[model samples]
Each structure stands twice: as C-alpha cells, then as structure tokens.
Target: MDGSFENAAGQARARVALRWRRIGFSALVLGSCAALLGLMAATLFVEAPDPVGIAMLLLFALTLPWTTIGFWNAVIGFSLMTFCRDPAGLVAPHLRSIGGTEKIASSTALLICIRNEDTGRLQRNLGWMLEGLVASGESRWFHLYMLSDSNQAPIIEDEQRVAAELSARFGSALSITYRRREESSGFKAGNIRDFCERWGSLHQFAIVLDADSVMTPAAMLRLVRIMQVQPHIGILQTLVTGLPSASPFARIFQFGMRLGMRSYTLGAASWQGDCGPYWGHNAILRIAPFTEHCHLPVLPGKPPLGGHVLSHDQLEAVLMRRAGYEVRVLPEENGSWEENPPSLPEFIRRDLRWCQGNMQYFHFLSLPRLLPVSRCQLGLAIAMYLGAPAWLGLMTLGLLRQMPIRADLGALLFILTMVMSFAPKFATLADVLARSPLRQAYGGTARILVSAFLEMLFSMLIAPISAVAVTLFMLGLPFGREMGWSTQQRDAEGIPFALAARRLWLQTVLGFVFAVCFWRVVPGAVWLWAPFVLGLAGAIPLAMASADPRVGRALAAVGLCRIPEEARLPAEPEYATLFAPCAPLSPTGATE
Candidate 1:
C-alpha cells in the first residue's frame, strides 16, 4: 500500500511539472499571435484612405492596444500571494487590519436569509465560511441568522430541518431564524423588512446574505470592522468572486472570471472611488440607516412596470448615498463568495431580472438624488457594461448593411477592450499560484501555459452563446414570466428537458444569424463575435458542470479536454489548520 501511494504521488508531481512547461509554450504562441496582429493593425492604419478601409483600420487600431492588455491580464490576473490581485486586495484586507476599527460583536447580526434553499448545500457553505472564521479566531465576535421564505410542503420541512440543526449546535454563539412571511406583499425586500422591524433595534448592523453567497473567514471580519469605523458607510459592497461547481465549462468560467471582467470591476471602482455599483448581497449594512433611511419606495405601477425595486441593491446604494452615507466597494478582502449560473440559460434568466432593473435606470438617470455625481457614476458603470451588447449589435448591423463605417479608433478601442477583458485573468492566476500549496499540485509552468490557451479557446466559444442569450433575454423581457425570489436548485447535473431545449434553440438561432453575417460581411468582424461562438459551443458541458462536481460523474473532465501541453493541473488542498470553527449546527423545527 505504501509503495502504491508513493507511486501515485510521484506520478502527480511529474504531471504538474509537465503542465507548466505546456503553459509557457502556449503563452509564447499566443503572445506571438497578439504581437503580429498588433503590427498588422498598426501598418494598416497608416495606409487607410477609403471609408471602408478606414473603418476597418480604425477598428483594428482600437483592438490592438487592448490585445496587449488582455494578453498581460491573462498572464497575471490570478496572483496567488496578493490575497486576490483583482479587487479584494484593494479594500477587504485594508479594512481587516485597520487600527481604529472596532469589533462589533453581537452588535451586528449577519443574516443568511433564504427561500426554498437546499438545507444540505446551505449548511455546507455556511459551515465552510463560519469554520474559517472560528479557526481565524472570530467566533465570539459575530452572530449568524437565517431567514427563510419557504411556504410550500417539502421545502418548508427541509428548511426547518436546516434551521433546527444549526440552532442546536451553536445555540448561544449562533442563532438560526426562519420566517414564511406575513404575505408576499413586497417580495424579498418585504421579508427582510419584517426582520428589521422585529429585530432591527437589537443589532447595530445586519449583513444581508443571499442563499448562494459564501464568504471567506477574513471577508466577514473586515465587513464588521468597516461597519465599526466608518459609521456613516451604509453599504460597503464588494465585487464578488463567483465560483461555480465543476466541469470544463464551469472550471474555465469560475477561474476565468477573475481574469476577465473582475479587473474592470476593480479598476472601475478604484478609478471612480465612491460610486461603486451595488451587487445586492455579500455586503454590510447599518440597521438604523437601512430601516430609517434606506427603506425602498414603491414605484407606482403594475406588473413589470412597477413594484418594490427588483434590483434593490442599486436602489439601496443610491438611497444610502442620498441619505448622506457613502456606498462603496472594499476590494481588500475576498470574504463573500457566490455561485455563478453554471449554464447560459440560468445566466440569461438572472440577466433578464437585471435588464428590467437597468431599464429603470435609464428612467432614473435624470433623478438628481438617484444620479448624483457619485450615484451617477453607478449609472455610468451600468452603461459601460451594457455597451457590450450595443457594440456587438453595431458590428453585426454594420456588416449586414455592407455600409462603410469608420473602424479606425473603434477597432483599436475594441482590441484594447479585449485585452482589458482578459488581462485581469492572467494577473489573478499569478496571484493564485503565489498562495496555493498546490503550487506543486497545479504543475510547474508548462501546464499553466497550456491551460491558458485552452481557457482562451473555451472563452471565445462561449461568447456567441452569451451574446445571443443576452439578446434573447432582452427581447423576451416584454413577454417574460414574472420571476420571483427563487432558490438555487442543487443536484448532480440535473437540467430539466424544458430548460435545456429553450436554451439550445435560442443559441442555435443566434449562432446562425451571426454566422451568416460573419460569412457575408467583413470577415474581420467575426473575431469580435468570438464571445458568442465560444459560448454556444460549450453550452452542454457548462450545463453538466453546474451540477455538483463532487458527485464525480463528469460529462467531460475540464483538464483532460484541453491543455495536453502540460501533464497535470493542480487541485486545492484542504487547509484544516485554517478552519476549525462553525461546528455543524443541530438545526431546529421551530420558526422564529
């Protein structure tokens, strides 16, 4: 047995080393492609005179600068040592160690309010985080509260079971509370309102957590300290690091996110300062400020047109700012983590809700309180991300028309945009390497390089899937069903037939449209459409990954499918010394 175990370990190490070598080689190949593309674009720009040529030239120019950025971000986006080079390094850690900060023990109750959530999965997430906190020596300083909205049969039982279990173990140190609701009057916001009115005065602050949210031990501490020192900060939300289950598509995505969009979020917040976008959950709030000043106003109207703010996060931030408290994002910690929709269908469903909320932003842009310079920065952030679809739309429409549009600067901007999009991932990866003991596990250098290439390939394929998904959701809004406060379903790769069909069909139509235009129009534009294509191709695999990866039956092993340039990729080690708190809760059957 000893001989066999040693042999296995030896094999793993060999594989990891080979993997890094592959990574280096892949990086060289990609770097060469980007450099050559940059040269081509630069040379073309100097010779353009015709309108069509100029437009293409401009487009190329816009793209090249970002190519450099995207390439660099890909290189270092996941830095291991910086405690997350993306956004957490910016604020969470800073607040954690700040001297004047006071610990608000029991004074603040961090609530993990839920509706129809799987108690087993909830316990797992809650367990991991709280354990990390206790191991880090913060068990006594905080209290955990859970609010449930399960009114139905099986769900209510599971929820009660979960609540009772948690209440039993940490009865005094931890508290689990559940509520079905007096009525569905205001939806989720109302459920929370009742909590505040009932127990609001007992605690100075209440950290609101969604069912899917997971926080690092330190992330929770920083939130409390920040609330303590910055008395006027009504909400200091962080840019979340979303982790999905497992599979080629899921792993690639969960990891790639920090690489791509996360940096932009970090940069946007850093550059803009006080005007960060509100992500709703995974944030801290003062009870007095929220209840007395931040209560949401009902917009006078009916279905889809009006009701309590569906996008309450944005409204909360705007209201907080209006009430003289600063609403900001602290990147210093990676305390709060959440789940990303593993597949395109779920992603679009989630986005539909956002679009409806954002559509309202267009209306509120003129509201002085809603769009004050600090708050207006929030709107501007919305437009910056939203511009992606519009920009893609332009590329599509322009090609279909065969109209001569200038692409000179536009091309450069778009290229730089891609770089900005991907570079953060590289930086984030580097950070990850610096921290994980899996340094040996992830392979030496070759594997990282190969993984990067495969990662990029997968990213491109998903692009079209996402673009069309976004477009479809936007179009479907007018006739869409009234989405409610739904719980995230957890199962081992269980995607119902109806949901799968709806997604596949929509993707097929969108891909065909883009493909036709790509063939008929300027062939160059198809590169920009990489987003949609990559996504559609990877849809099936992503769907499979969303189910619990631990369940073991993988549709396709993400590591095996790509990155053969390396031998073996690394896996995260269980750092037991780091987490010993959050002993499993006994759970209760009684409702609070």
Candidate 2:
C-alpha cells in the first residue's frame, strides 16, 4: 500500500511536468505565430490599409500556424538530432528500457488491414515479416490477422488464397487467420471494429499494418516490449518512412518526406509527448482500450463530410487519450516503411482524400472530454488543409487588388516565409551531412546534395499543384464531391499524357491565367509568383513526366533521389529481394 502511494505520487509529479512542458510549447508556438502575423499585417497595411488588404491578411493569418509550427518543430528537431545522443529515448522514455531481449509476455495480433490489394506483393511482405518473427523465437506471442474489406469476388478469392498459402507455409510455427467482411460498413475503421468484436479480447495489443506497410521483426519486437512495460501508452506510432521506389515522383517526394519527417516528428514528439499522432497504419494499439473507447461516432449527416469518420486515426488517438492513456510516437526511423503514391495524379488523389477527411474534424472541435492538446491537434489537422485555400485566396486577392508598394519588406517576408516552409527538410539535410555514417548511408555528400537540390525543385512544383487541387476539392465538398474508400494503385506505372491532361486541365488553365495576369499587372513581381504559376501552368506535363517509366529509369540509373535503402542491401534478406528490381544498375548493366 505504501509502495502504491509512492508510485502514484511519482506519476502525479510526471503529469505535472508534462503539463508544464505542453504549456511552454504552446506559448512558444502561439508567440511565434503572433509575431509572424504582426509582421504580415504590417507588411500589408503599412502602405494603404484597405479592405482587400485586410482580407489578404486574414487569409495570410490562416496560413501562419501551419508554417510556424513546422518551422519551430524543425528547429527543435535539428537541435536534438545534432546535440543529443538518444533523442528518441529522451522523447519516448519507455523505449529506453527496451533492450531487444525482453521476454514477450503479452499476446499481440498483427492486424494487416486490406481492401482489394495486390495479392502477390501482400504475400511476399507478410511472408518476410512472419519469417523474421519466427526467427526471433517469439512467434508464439504474435498472431497474424488478415482483416479484409475487399468486396470484389476476384479480389476476395485472391486474398483467401494468399492467406491460405501463408497459413500452410507457417504451419504450427505461427498462427494466421483470414476474415473478410461482405459489406465494408465503416470502411477501414469498421473493419478494425469487426476485428475488435471478434478477436480483440484475446490479445493485449494489436500492431496495425496497412496493405502497403512493412515492418522488420526487430521493430515489431521493440513496439511490443515498449507496450509491455509502458502499460499507460494506448497507441505507439512508429516513424514510418517510404520504401525505395522506382517511380521518379515517389523517389523525389519521399526523399523530401524522409528528410522532413525525421526532424518534424522528433520536434513534435518533444512537445506533444503522450498526445502524439496516430497515422492509421504502422502503429501499435492496446486492443482493450482501443476497442472500448475508440469506436468512432458516425457524424449527423450524409456523404462527404458526414457518415463515418474517414480519418479515424486522429480521432482514435484523442479518444484513447481521453481514456487516460498515452498516445505516443517513437520518432526513430527504425525498420518500418510504407509505399508512397507513384505519380502526381495518384498523390493528389490520396492527398485530397485526406483533405476531405481532415475537414470533417470541424464537427468535433467542441467534443466533450477531449484534452486541450487533443483539440489543438484536431484544429491543426483542419488548418493543414485550410492553408491551401487560404493561400489561393491570398493569391486571388493579390491579383484582384493589384496593390503595389514596399518591395523591401515584401521580399524579406517572402524569403523568411520560404525559409520557414523548407526548414524541416533543410534541418535534416544539415544533420545528415554533418554525420559521416549518415552521409555514407545516403550515398555520400555529392549524391545527397544533388538529391536535395532536385527534391527542393520537386517540392516547389508539387506544392502549388497540390494546393490548387485541394482548394478546388474543398470548394466542391458542399456539392458532394466525395472521395469514397477505394483500393489504391500501389504499384508504379506510367500515367498516360491523355489521362494526365484530362485530370489536370483545370490546373493547367488556371496556372496560365494566373501567370498572364501577374505578368500584365506586376511584370517585375512575376519572379515572386514564378513557382506557383509555373507549377500550375505545367501541371499536365509535370504529371506525365513524373510518371513516365523512362524518367524513373533515368533517375534510378544515375542514382538521383536515391534513398538509403537503395544504396546498400538491407540486413533483412527479404528487403533485399523486395528492393532488388528497383536497384540502380552498375555501368556494366549489372545490379550494383
């Protein structure tokens, strides 16, 4: 009884420390945003403060929080990466105790959620993970569940076949179960709910994996061990990186993402602490709490912004936290990865879906019992999509008002904003260059520099295009523009010019219109709007070129935008096999 009291007191003290840390971080973020907003207001209103200028300032204010948060997160992340020996351990203290030899005491269900995916790829990924787990000598504590939402007859048959093959191969060494829902009621969330009702009671933890997700046995073991010791943690999300891709779009996009995520996640985790993000997949959940408390509520409407919650991860995280459990992120780029969209069109499609989902969070802002941090997270998620429209609105206002004046302050603000926008990637790039092993892992300083330069250009081009797409989509949400749940095209494939043109014609036209308008009114300021205008105008061609197999092959051949996983064979033979086809060839035409 005395020891229990001491433990409770210690926990109370820790909670107080965490609360103060949150308050400090909140102050920092709010202060930075306030300063930036003031600067933007002064820059706009100092000359001839008009209603249009005020409107532009309002839109600019909408854009400040996201950029400010990112900039600060990058700053904090870079400092930790450069100065601390154990940054991940510092943020996620539960991880420090995991030494890889912990005895597995809790039952964990490896939930692989699928909906009409490539069966062959699924088999290979699962086989590799299962083999690794068996080799780790802890297969008994883990069970594999193929929870399918595939309704198509052929795809269902394929899923069953793959599951049966995997079960036969593993035999008694591992347990594998396959369950398919005839009607995918709540989509992925519903599929997970079905699993909870059926088998969640049997397991203490569930390591959720998307169809495209692949995790090394070591990563899984580490997660399980952390959960065993830190019973307070309800969800633990791994820092998921992108797999080596043959697609030029994916290669460049993920290179930037890889750089940005390390610093961004580390920084966010430092402040976020227990109320971290859950990105749907590549994370582990405590089955009992998740099943009991995280059942998503159907919104009080119809399709689009109603019905079931599309972005269930964040909601689940908040719910889990509301249940007095911690939702944390590991922040370390361990052996966990997922496939990225291979082309601009696919990327836009996936992104817009998220936009629609995140926009739905507007309904839950005043949700009862949610922590302040939890509410802040939801607001941030909403603001993320809202920034696109806000940016476009600012652009529209600039074009309409055609206001001319102080170039000095305008240029300074522009430069500073751009710097803040790209801080995360630049921060990580600096850290990588500073470390020898990291530089070598990413294929030396020269290659890394080239990759970074190209990726920066890629990001500039993609950002405007995505912003425009999101702006248009959000505008159409009221008229029932819904991106219903569907099977994503996971494999890299060429996007036809005709298809690209059909999809991106509006962006193309809008780009040219903006360019011509900016050129006519403010010819000198064309350089200022060049990135956005050029990206919009060149949308179709950019989409087509990025998805061209020849372009991908050319980039791969020269080792441009190569991830570390592509430079050297991974320790896991399975990863080697998976990445072999995408590996760069030597000058002699042999795989290097």
Candidate 3:
C-alpha cells in the first residue's frame, strides 16, 4: 500500500478509537448508575406507610419514576423516532405551501421580546429577519413590534431611546411599542402576555422570536402564512436547531440536535392536530386566540419555582388544547436558529429550570382533555427530568438492605426508562444516513458512526451528575424556594477545562463514595458497581460538548461550522437588504 494510504488508514483508526473510548467511558458510568438503582429496587419496602411518610412518599413517588423513566425514554425513544423511516407525523399539516409569491400581500405581525438585553445584537437579528421578510415581499403584511420589560426608573431613558429609534426607523409601516413598568412581574410569559393584550388587539397574528434567535425572512413569512391559513392553530412552534459557534462541544451537538431533533419534531408536530408542546420561540400565533386564551396565572408560591408554570410552553399548549385550540410544531419551516450555551456551567443552569418545571407536569397528568400522544409526551418530559435522583435513591436503599439485584417490575422500568432517553441517539444516527446531504454537513457517515460511542459516553457521564442535581432539587423543594426564571448564558466566554473539571469534582467524589459504600454492603451485581461510580467521576467531562479534544479535531477536520455561515447572506446595507426584495408594500387598500 502507498505510504499516504497507510497514513490515512491510521488516522481513520484513531478516529474510531477515540469514539469508542468516549462510549466505553459512558457505558461504565451508566452501568454503575443502573446497578446502584437495581440494588435500591431490592430494598423498597412495601410496608404500610403512616400518614406523614405516606404523604411525603406520595410526592416523591409521583415525581421519581417520571424523572427516571421519562428522562431516559425521551433520550432513547426520540432517538429511535428520529432514525425510523416511518413517514407518519403525529399531527396533521395545517398550512399549505404558497411558494413563488412575490406580491405585498398577507399582513402578519412580528413580535420581538426583550428584557435588559444587548440592544445591538437584538437589532442585528431583528434587522436580519426584517430584511428577509421584506426581500420576500411579505413585509407589507408583516408589522414589527418591540416588546420590552425594562423597568429601571433610572435607565428608563436608554430603554425608551432604543424603542424610539426602532419606531422612527420603521415609521407607520413598522409598529414598535415599549411597556416599562416600575414592578416587572411574571417573567417572559408575563411580558409576552402584556404585549399580546395591548398589540395583539391590533394585528391578525405575530411571529415571536427569542432575543438571540435569528429567523430568516422566508421562514418568518412561511410561518405566518401557515398560521394565517390554519386559524384553529393557537401557536405554531418550530423545531429549533442550534447554530453553534467555534467551540468543540457546540459543533458536535449542533449536528446531533439537527439529526436528533428534526425528524422527531416532524413526527410530534404531525399528530392528530394535537400539537405536543410549543417551545416559545421562532413560532407564529394568531393574536386573538393567544390574547383571549393564553392568560398565565401568577401561581400562589415563591420561586427556584413558584407563582407560574416553569414549563410555560408545554402548559400553554395543554391549556390551548383544553380550550379547543390547536398547538403544534412546524418541522418544514427553516432559518429559525439558536446558539447552544458555550459552557457546561451555563448548560446546567438552563437544565435545572427545565427539571423543576417538567416535574410539575405531574399535577396535570390525569387531565382528560389532552390527547393520548400529548399526554405521553408530557410524561416523557417528567421522566427525563427526574431520572437521576430516582435511580440513585433506589440504589442507595438497596445497598443499605443488602439485597440481590431484583429482576422484577421496578428493574424493568429502570432499564426501559433509560432506553427511552437514549433511543433517540441511535435514531438520530439512522436519520443522518437516510438524508445524504446532512452527511456532508456532519463530515461523513464514516465519521458519524465512529462518533456514536463518544456521544453515548457523553450521555453516561452527564447522567449521574444530572441525577444528583435533580434529586437535590426535588428533595430541596419542601423548603419552598422556586427556581427563578433565569436568562440563558449566550455569548459567554468558555470556561477552561481545568476549571470545568474542578467544578464537577464534588459530584464525582460523592458518586464514587456512595457506589463504594453500596458495593461493600451488597457485593453481587457488577452492574450495580459500575455506572454510578463512573458517572460521579466521569463528571470530569465525558459527555460535555467540549470535553474531548479529539472530538474537536474531528469536527474541524470536516469543515463543519455551527453558527450559520455569514457568507450565506448578502453584504448589502440593512435597509437595502431589508426591504429591497420585498415587493414595495402596495397599500392593500385595507386599514388596520
């Protein structure tokens, strides 16, 4: 063989080796967690509970299985759904394609929500979308609105300045309104609700965008046209793909999310007109249904979690569905994108809120109005969020009792739960293969296959740490602190590897100690001894996007970029590009 051929083969082997290394590491971690959980299952007492213990266990029991089972199921089940070749969607398509129209027609409203945000970046994204909308000749029908929740008596001037500038720029064609109150309440939902009440009265519908989300002109109009046509649809949420930056972890996940989430999103969005959940971003909604039907109650309690639904989007979908409205995901739409958190710390901060909110779904699990598929989805979220702690608790109890690993119902559920969570990963693999172009995007099927083990390994490492975090939060809930609605960490500098490693050290230590303690007491199943301990120490950064430097090289070797390539857009000035292509909004001879 030629020396060049030999070198290339050697490099390929190295790639495969690195991928397996990560996978093995992950399996070790998961095996330990499952083993510990199995041990715990052997010890659960079926004895009658006193009122107090029964009440407490009632709270824990409802939440525990959902967390363990649901978490794993989403990861795995969604993975399978993504990979499957089935053409059926869970929801029926509501909007018909109106391709090749260049007329100034359909008047849709654009809603942009902001709260103490970087105005420049906000302006850039808004401009980006506006330019696209106008270029596509949909601007005449599309009015832009800047909804604000800035309430500083002092900095109020700056907020007003920005809003005023935006209004002046758009004039009567673009409507920009700002609502700054002394006391800001209800978070994003509150802000949006307030806007809907005031302006939702004016427009037919609005396409809502997160501060960082960049929606293309075509996507915005496509979403609006669909919502306009599908009157029963309260909110049309899309499957948001991550636009990763120049970071190791973000790039890999960008590919993972596209393949992992897109097909399932398509499947979920297609259910019997029963939209599973709206993610509150890059989706369009009719003004009347939302304003009239989407009033969020300030729940009685303080927040890490009181006073409102933490998972507001899911609950909103449920309420809408209950009120005889249609809520769903739009998979065929494109150009709506978001950036992944730059680091591990930021990632966890975002997840904690999800964990707390999804767990609250137990309160509505039995509601009769929701479709079976939607309910299954709600249940899935609960399981995914609470997975770690429940598994750990069962493991802890089993070791204390010195019992053999039970092969009964509980054990089966534990395994099934995990399979559901991760099944999505394998499915994602299958999805990439079916679509040949995405293979070019991901480097190659050759590389992707090699990378699966590393991906699996990443999952195993994060599970225990996540389990502990969820368990602590669940246990800590009686103290009555609500996890507040925190802004995500976007555009932040990445934490160094050494610092990130130290951050997880505490978790690693505790996981190891607990597993060892259990192994000493109940020495039978090696599964019991493997994952938890691995998970605990694996927190050093196995699954973390940026953890494996080899993965980083692999990503770069393929010319894969996470954030949207700027060259994809033209270099014309904002307004030049903004409305240049949008056929001049001919007066529809209609008044708003």
Candidate 4:
C-alpha cells in the first residue's frame, strides 16, 4: 500500500514537470514572436509615420508570429530528438510504460473509405495490405471493409467491379466486404459516420484508412496492442510518411518532409499527449467513444464556414478529449504510408481545399466545452493559411510606403527571420549525419547534403507562389467561391505547359507586377524582393520541370534525393499485372 501511494505521487510529479516543459515551449515561441513584432514596429515607425506604414507594421506584427511558431516547433523538435531520452514517454506517462505484449482482446475493423478513387490502384493497395496481414498471420484478428461515397455512375461501377475482384481473391482468406453511398454528403467524415451508425457496435476498435493509405500487419497489430493496454485513449494517430515517388519534385519534397516530420512529430507528441492530432487517415479509434462523442455538429452558418465542418478530424479529437477520452499520436511508430500531390498545381489545388477547411475553424474556436489547447490548435491552423496572405500584404504595403533611410535594420531582421524559419531543414540534415545507417541509406553525407541544398532551393522557389495561391483562395470564400471534393492526383506525371500557365497565370502576373514596381519605384529593394517575384514569374516552367519523370530519374540516379523506403520497396508484391485488365477504363470512370 505504501509503495502504491509513492508510485502515484511520483507520477503526479512527473506530470507537473511535463506541464512546465510545455509551458516553457509556449513561452519561447510566443515571446520571440512578440519581440520580432516589436522590432518590426520600431523599424516601421523610424521609416514612415503614415497610415499605410502603420498598417503595414500592424500586419507584420500579426503575420510574423506564425512563422515564429513554426520556427520554434522545429527548434524544440531538433533539441528533443538530439538530447532527450524516452521522448514519447516524457509527454504522456501512461504511454511510457505500456506493455508491448498486452493481449489483444478487442475486436477491430480495418476501414478503407473512398470517393471516386481509381479502382485499380485501390484494389492493388488493398491486395498488398491484405497479403501483409495474411503473412503476419493476424488476418483472423481483423476484418476489412471498403466504404465508398462515389457519386459518379461509372466510377461506382468501377468500384463494384474492383470489389468483385477483391472478393474473388480474398473471400476465403479474410472477411472482406464493400458498401457505396449515393450521396457523399459530408465527404469522408460522413462516410465514416454512416459506418459508425450502422456497424460500429460490432467492434470495440476501428482502424481508419484513406484510399491511398497502406500499413503493414505488424504495425496494425502494434497499434491494437497499444489501444488494448491504454483503454483511456480515444484515438491513436500514426506518423504517416509519403510513399515513394519517381517524380523529382515529390522525391525531393517528401524526402525533406520525411526527415523533418520525425523530429517534429516526436516533439509535438511529447507536448500534445492526450490532446494530440488526428490526420483523418492512418489512425485507430475507440469505436464506442468515437461514435458517442465525435458526431460533428453543423456550425451555425451557410456553406463553407456555417454548414458541416470540413476539417472534422481536429475537432473530433477535441470532442473525444472533452468526453473524457485521450486523443494521441505515436511519432516513433512505423508502417504507415500515404501519397502526396505529384506536382505544383496539384499541390496548390490540395492546399486550397485545406485552406478553406481550416479557415472555417473560426466558427468553432469559441464553442462551449472546448479545451484551451484545442482552441490554440484551431487558431494555429487558421494562422497557417492567414500567414501567407499576411506575408504578401506586408511586402506589397512595404513596397508602397516611402522609406526614410536605407532600411538596413529592417533588412537584417528579415534575414534573421528567414534563417529561423528555415532552421528545421538544417536540423534534419544534422540528424541524418548523426545516424550512420540513415546517412548510408541516403547515399552518404555528401549526397544527403546536396539533396538538402537542392530541396531548400526548390522549396523557397515554390513557397511564395503557393502562399499567393492560398491567399487568393481564401479571399474567394466571401464571394461564394467553393472548393468541391474530388479524387486527388497521386502520380508524378508532367502537366501540359499550357495547363500549367492556365493554373499559375495569376501568380505570374503578380510576380511581374511586383518586379516592375520594385525595379522602377523601389530599385534599392529589388534585390530583397526579386526571389519572390522570380519564383512567381517562372511558376509555370518550374511546375512543369519539377513534374518531369526524366528530371526526377536523373536526380535519383545521381542520389540527389533518396529515401530508404525507395531502396527497400515493401516486401509485398506490387501486382502490376493484376491491374492490367482494369487499365482500359475511361478516365471519367476512374480517378487518375
């Protein structure tokens, strides 16, 4: 009895310490942001005291902090990954001592949700995933369900055909089933809700997956074991990384993301604990809690912001936590994979959709029964999209305001801010070099360094254009411009030059205008603004070149960007020939 009391007291003390660490992290981010804003205010006041200048300063103060938050997140992540032991356990004490061999007493259903997705790719991935489970001899412990919200007739037909094929192949081996909805009312969230209302009671746990998602049987089993041990947890999200892509842009982009995400996820997990994130896919949920608590409410407004919440995952986490269940993320876990947009236009298109979804969070932040941390997370998501326009606005307003002096201090501060924002890339590189196996997997330190450098260059070039595009999308919202849901393009194929131009012309024009204005009206600042302008001006060509398979192949051959997953390829067969019969289907009948 005495030992039990002492253990409980020790656990309480550790929780207090963890809270202090999180508080310190928050202070570092907020305090640095405030200091940066003050410096910008001083610089603006010293230059021009006019209304435009004051507004510019105010906007700068508001926008600059978003970058600071990201900067500090990376910095803290780097520090933790480098120095800390038991990173996951540090955040949530319950997670620290979970028994690995916890018996899996709960029944789980593996769910795959789709909306007008490519049947062949879907079937291929499904087959491979099932094969993994069968190989692991855990197929009996899990049931597979294919849930579709595809509205198009031909696409639905294709889905049925693929279901027939999958049923034919795995009917005897596993319990596989399919269902399609005529109306994709609330999109993925609605599809899942339908499942919950009808079939959720049959299982104690559910593993949710997107159309492009794949996970190994061992990974799935680990997730289940964790849930079995930690019954208080409502959801457990995996740190999903991008699948291998042959496109140069995806190769470079995903490689950097894969490296950085490890550290960032660990740091975030340590802080978030029970108040963690849900990325909609590659996650497990406690069926009873989710069904009872996570039915999303219709925000009291019209379309977009007012109607059904588009960004439901984050809010669902909040609701689950409110209902006395923990929502969590496992950054150290593996065997989760998803596809990224293959090219720039596709990336922007996807970002636009997310931008609208995130922007809608403005309605829910003030909702009753919400946790303060959940509110902060929602605000941060809003700032992410808002920051882009804020940056663009700051630049445009700065260009217009008259400069009293050479603005040397402002220039220095800007450079420092840029460095802080980019520190994560460097930190990731440092981590790569520290691990010998990871370094060799990336083709040695020299190749890794080169890859990082190239990735940074291309990312900088891509950043401004994407920002401007997102800003425009946000602005279009009030005018009733909506982003409709559709199947995402996952291949890394080059788009037509004209199509690229059509998609990126606004950014090109904005870049050209900014360049000419700076050159004629503010020649001294042209050097500072040229990069942003050039990136936008050449957006079309850049997108095309980045998506070119030949370019991606060339870079890969030279070891510019290579992830370990590409080298290993999953052990499960690709089954390319099996998808051959479904190839001749029209694009209208299948997602590309």
Q: Pick the candidate with the highest lDDT.
A: 2
Backbone clashes counted, model 4? 1
Clashes of each: 99, 0, 65, 1
Task: Write model 3 residue lDDT over 1-592, tens digit each, in one string.
Answer: 6999996898577546645544553454356446544443442434433343333333345444433432343343354355544433322334443443534345566767666666766766665666565566446677766666654444456657766776676666555566664555777777778777766777777777777787777677667666655566787777677764544566555655654565455433433244456888788777777777678666555654556667777777777777777776665425678767655566676777788787677766886777654676687677776556655665565555432333465456556555655554556567666667666545566666766655565556666777776677778876864566655656534566677666677787887787678677755555645676776766666535464444444455444432223223234334333222111223452111
Candidate models: Cα lDDT each: 0.57, 0.89, 0.59, 0.79
- Flag regions of model 2 displaced more than 4 Å: 1-10, 570-574, 586-592
Models 1 onward score TM values of: 0.72, 0.97, 0.74, 0.93
Q: Which portions of model 1 miss their true places by more than 4 Å?
A: 1-106, 128-141, 381-389, 404-414, 426-444, 478-482, 492-499, 523-592
TM-score of 3: 0.74
Model 4 misplacement above 4 A:
1-7, 92-99, 525-527, 569-592
Q: Give model 4's TM-score versus the native structure.
A: 0.93
Instruction: Name the lDDT of candidate 4.
Output: 0.79
Residue-level lDDT of model 2, residues 501-560, one tens digit each, is 998999999999998888987788766899888899999889888877667777878777
* Residue range 11-99, candidate 1, lDDT tens digits: 57754654554455346536755665555445344554446545544444333333443454344323323444434444233344456
2 or 4, which is superior by lDDT? 2
Question: Which prediction has the highest TM-score against the true structure?
Answer: 2
How close to the true structure is residue 114 of candidate 4, measured as C-alpha lDDT?
90
Clashing pairs in 4: 301-306
**Lowest-sum lDDT 10-residue window in model 1:** 576-585
